[model samples]
Target chain A: MSRRLAAALRPAAAIGCALAAMAIALALLGASPLAVAADLADGAFGNWIAFTDTLARATPLVFCGLAVAVAFHGALWNIGADGQLVVGALAAGALGPALAGAPHTLAIVAIIGAGGLAGALWGGLAGWLRARRNVNEVISTIMLNFIAAQLLSWAVHGPLMEPSGAFPASRKIAAAARLHLYFAPTRLNLAMLFAVALAAVCELGLFRTVPGFELRALGRNRRASAFFGLPIARLTVGAMALSGALAGCGGAVQISAITHRLYETISPGWGYEAIAVALVARLSPLGVVPAALLFGALDNGSQAMQRADGVPAQLVYVVQALVIIVMLAFDAAAGGGWRELLEGGAPDRPDATAETCDA
Target chain B: MLEAFAASTIAMATPLLLAALGELIVERAGVINIGIEGAMLAGAFAGVAVAHATGATLAGVAAAIGGGVAINAIFAFVAVNLAVNQVVAGTAIDLLAAGVTGMLYQRIYGATGRAFTVAPMRPIALGPLARLPLIGRALFDQSALVYLAFALVPAIAWTIGRSRFGLSLRAAGERPEAADALGLGVYRLRWIALLASGALSGLGGAYLTLAYADTFVEGISAGRGYVALAVVIVGRWNAWGVAAASLMFGAAIALQFVLQAAATAIPYQLFLALPYLLTVAVLALMGGQADAPSALGEPYIRA
Candidate 1:
């Protein structure tokens, strides 16, 4: 088989394995696996509304997945995307009211810009620590995620709390600041459009731009990159910041378009799941699109599975975990297609020796 | 006030110390086991389920150890044998634990009202030590796990730093190829380290449900496992350092309780962030990458 076809088949085979495992699990629960599968399919793609909602749900994942994918290409672990996302949501929510008096375009732009900047700062902090201080990004990012959670709760409950004091959430943004709802009843909005556009941008930035080449070069061999005069520290920080900006964009889109206001819980661990999404996509920016949608469908379908089949909604988390494991197995079995995928299949792969384990 | 804080700090530190010490061993054996969290969660679930079912805390703790071992065995298979991405595999283990535990809790307990609550393990007071002043009483009077956790520090420190096995374990992590060339059986050494760490991590988890909280809450392990990860870093991967760092984090938790009770103006979330903030702050101060094991996250293959 062609390497590309084998690469594509790897994920498909992994998905099949994951489904079989879930089927066995369902049997243990005394539920019909076939019925659960049918219900899940129905919930995710049964009708136009379900499909649209699935796409709507996929929007945030697309952005976050791309964020993770881009960072992973440079051999960076940006687990703080979740924290960055929350800060994005918080920034947009806090700024929404202040921008009500401005023109619609300016108000929207400012909210998005503020959100992106907040995310960038958060991501940049970890990147800076990794670059300058030699701190491990994984641990720092995880700690930052905890701090971000507290910050979100503090804001929701203390500062930007609703006027009525009945709920732990900020007041809904001014109607004008909210993104236009497209294909009503499905929560589809302009944010999905932006996510798609950004995915394209990420593709160009990673493969076409000079900075992208340097970043990829750094990822391939830091020793060589440094010897060749690449600014290793600066590129690391920039890639991380840009990665955070994308995730922050996700948080902004989610709050502005779907939630319409910041709440105590804005995401159901999309940032964590985005790791699986990006990894499964082999760190391909374009590949992240379908992978995100697959996750969205799993999430959307889990709700249906719960409603129609008496299964616990937490089943989706199980499937997600299984997917990551299965994908890793497949990638390993393929003798490191993961590295090739991340390096975007260049003719001269500089990172042939790079192991997927670090990621 | 100081005495009360000191006593609570010991309580909070036991679990963190156990997990960190366990992670220390795992990292020393060439595997950065992120799945320590998952193993701890499994132990937590097993401890609560068995204790609640059989009405024996000791039995529950044993089962928890077994559960932790089982989870780590899977980790060994993937990380040591298949040589998959350790972070992704570890994360998958965590998610699997969360989902399985949550679903089982819901199915068995029915997602409503108070779930089954086991009797919290009573602290055992050492004869004369219990009668002593503030420091003595707090230190000597504690659950068996607390004592085990503290005692393990020297035991672990010696086993890792002085023993022949210790040299081999470090050799495996530092340079697996060299270790293998010397006929040390790198995979075998790593598996042993993983199993040992799993048992310790499990003991920590059981301490939470059977001794600390005395009940199971969904995701009750919470961020403690991850906090233990930070503690490993803050501890500089040393046993005594782990104890000190864990105590510091324990103090952070105790301070949160004291602060929350002292005022209504300050949001409780600020205190919640204390340990995490401390972790980041410590990492910032430490400078970086000088202390990490060379082959810490690599999956060793007999290349």
Candidate 2:
């Protein structure tokens, strides 16, 4: 078989192996493997409502996934995306009510900008630390996530909290600021369209722009990029900040479109899950679209599986873990031959080695 | 007031010290095991489950080590062998552990609706040492884990600084290629370091369920693992440094609780956030010249 074909088949084989292993384990536990698969299908895409739910759920993943993908493409790891999302959502929640009497279009724009700017600022802090001080991004970002969570908790329960003193959540956003549902009888909103547009813009910026080339170059090798006169330090921080902004936008979308208010635990670690999504997509901005959807389907369906097949929703977490493991295993076994194909059969690959470093 | 604060601080610092020390060892050997959180979680669950099942705290401790080793083994294979991204692999392990433990807890105990409680490990007082003023009670009047954590600092310091094995481990982390050239098995040393870390981290987890909280709630580690990671950074990869950093963090955490109890005008959540905020500020001021092992976080593979 041709090398490219073999490369394409590797992931499929790994998935087959993973599923077979899971099936055997389930069977040993006295659960029908076939029944579980059928239930998963029924729960995720069994009906229009289910499909819409999956789409709605996938919305945040798409934003976060794209965020991670953009940063990963630049060879930066932005582990603080979760914290950025939280801060973004908080900004949107705080701003939404204050802009209640404003024109609908202006309020909506302000909310989105507030979320994106808040996320960017949060991300920018990490970037500044990394660029100016050479601090490890991973450790700093993770630490920031804790601070952000505590900050959010403090806000929701203290200053920004609803005066009624019910749950740990902010007052609801104004109707003018909320994103309208794109379709009737479903929670899917125009934010999905925005996500799609942003993903496309990221793709263009990564592959078509001169600055994108520089970012990709820096991602591939800091030394080489510096030699080529690319502002390596600046790019690293910028990539992370941009990545965080995307995640922050996702938080805003969740609050403005779905929840219509900021609540404690707005994300079930969507920022962290974005890492899995980005990795599974091989850190490609365009690839994140489908990868995020797959995660979305699993997440939306997990509850159904719990209710119907007596499986825990945590099973989705297991599946995600499995996907990352299998994907990495397949990617490693296939070698750079697959990566070359992933890079569109480019023989003179500039970023292949750096990409491997990223993985 | 001072006495109470000192006592609680010792209790809180024990787990962070144990976990941070474990992480320090692993990092010194050139591997960043982000799976400490997963290891701790597994230890917590296994420790509690075994304690409840066998009614022996000793067996629970043993089971916790075994569980931690099993989890680390998965990380070792994927990260060490497959050359996967260490951070991503570690994150996956964390998710996997969280998911599996949550499911198992539900499957085993969800039906009963009764809280699973075990006999807490009894504090071992050091007779004469326990009678001394504030220092004696805080240091001597504690469970075995607290004493072990304190002793571990000097023991680890001696091991890493003075022993031939420490030299070899340091050599491996500093330059795995050179270590390999010198006929030292880099992979084996790293593997051993990870397993040792697993044991200590597991003990830390057990401390949570068996000593600190005495019950298994979701996310019982409560970002302590991340704090441990920062402790390694702030400690600058030294055993004594880790101990000092852990105590600092522990004190910060304890002060939060004390302040919350005092119910001052300042919101309790602000106090809760103080440690993390301090960590970030310290890191920023310290300016990231951490001097981490050269090969730290990079998987070494034999060509």
Candidate 3:
């Protein structure tokens, strides 16, 4: 029990230090750090509507975070989730207009399926390169992001372009295909419920299945897993494809729930931002929920920080950097100092191990 | 028509070649510097900002080198000493550089204004080499940076293949433990390689601001650094091969521009997507089971 308490406290202490350091930096930059923090709190939770907005913003983040966490657990770095999300949104957008006369339920299903398939295909390509050709997924995924961006730009500017054609975005999806809002006067829609359900499913799949065990084994040591007769190549590809599917679903949810249209910049690096979420969550499915919500709040409140205190929106990114650095630092220090702590009449081994695993 | 294509292709390929060559060297020495994008961005901003400030093109070029190296040093500390994941560290640096440069630009020049421009580097006549008809303009009549990019290909190839220092560097990358056992310093070689890569990548960034666009803009590197990374893979990790691959991509990009200029029925945006599309296609086809350095992404800690 004491060990568990220490494990929880260690991360909290590290985070506290990180927050204090960021506050100092913000103050040094001539911004009222306290005011910015206050604004963030107010914007995120000062009212019921504001809190709903935070939840709405967190919807896509939840999907992307889980997508990243899934692949990361398999030791596959699917960095192209951003590109996958865009492609997914593009496909869903196209499907919505084409199937406008279809039955409502059918139209929604088609749009979601189309988006997932698009993301899966994009992600599968990276897996194919990694498994068959030994191309680094990191390089391939980054390259694919540029390709996806260009494809969206072309689509919005050409074939699927809105009639006005002044901006690079597609026409709004049919009303029948849009996700219904569960809460009136807020952007919160069925997507949040879907995200929560998906998170629950992912948690089960990861912790309770044979495939999950294989994936965890692969992540821990591919060579050893292979020696134990796991099909490493197929697993890597499968994991990446599934990861992409989730990210694509994220895009579909965004289009149906909020945007209602396919814009060229559908995601403002939401897929990339998912990396931070997954990392902060230590790639745990259960952990991703709170991490995504926290990040969503930070992102949503950043504008308020800028408006209320003249703090640059870029300061959020600085905080994210500091968070990652501090997390890693704390994990390392805790692990290294564990032996000393144990000798000094404190139980530290389990806590140190947990912290290392989180990292 | 072919002559025009070839000329523009060479012009387009110059920056990629410079950047890819730098990345190839650093990767060859075992440090996967994902911060190439950040380095390039820094160099691009510094190059343009200095030229705008000093009005001397040379000063701008020098400042770009300084900027690139400065960014790279930060990455080296995080990745080398702190043992942070290289990809994460690199991404952070890229984000930091993007945000910082964007803010600095806005602070200095204000939001609503056209960026300052610099005089582009003029092509040098190679005297006898300039007399050749079709090939001359394609190869000889190019900026100093263009020629330097081409020259570095063979120079890097020779140095990596033959030099004593190159052997030590390769040893460090291939098997750091073995290299350490043999009394070679793994850290030092990686540091030197990163610095050299910074200079070359910085030059690549300078090419954009000083030659291509002749002005600064947000995200102006426009994923070129990442493209250079693909170029290294498509080039099969060889310096000469990297040069050839860069030229191919350059030609692809130049063709898109030409098609746009000619106002073809096909959307110009599709044309813009061609290079990236080709990069993926090339990787799919050619990147087959090639062996990377043993310690490519792992940081060495003395245990």
Sorted into a CAPRI-style docking class, model 2 comes out as: acceptable
Ranking by DockQ: 1, 2, 3
In terms of lDDT, the poorest run of 10 residues in model 2 chain A is A341-350
Q: What is the TM-score of chain A alone in each candidate?
A: 0.92, 0.90, 0.90
Better by DockQ, candidate 3 or 1: 1
Top candidate (TM-score): 1
Model 2 per-residue lDDT at A139: 73
Candidate 3: residue pairs that collide: none
TM-score of 1: 0.95
lDDT of candidate 2 over A1-359, digit per residue (tens)? 99878765654565566667767756775678888877877888999888988888888898999887877666566778899999999899999888878898998889988999999988888888777766667777888888889889988998899989888989999999999887768887788888989989999998899888887776655655656667766887788888889988988888889998888889898988887787666776777888788788878877777787776677666666777777776776666842322222111112222354444
- Put down candidate 1 lDDT per residue, B1-303, tens digits, no spaces: 777777888988888888889999998787877788888998998988899989998899999999889889988888788777676678788888888888877777775525578988889999998878778756988999999999999999999999999999999988999999999999999999999988988998998899999998888777788889878778877899989999999999888877888886888998889888988888789765446677777777787
Q: What is the lDDT of residue B260 in candidate 2?
A: 85
As for TM-score, the candidate ahead, 2 or 3, is 2
What level of docking quality does candidate 1 show? medium
**Tens digit per residue, CA lDDT, model 1, A126-189:** 8898877777777788788889889999999988998998999998887767888876776877
Query: What does DockQ give for each predicted structure?
Result: 0.51, 0.44, 0.28
Model 2: lDDT to the true structure: 0.80
In order of lDDT, best first, we have 1, 2, 3
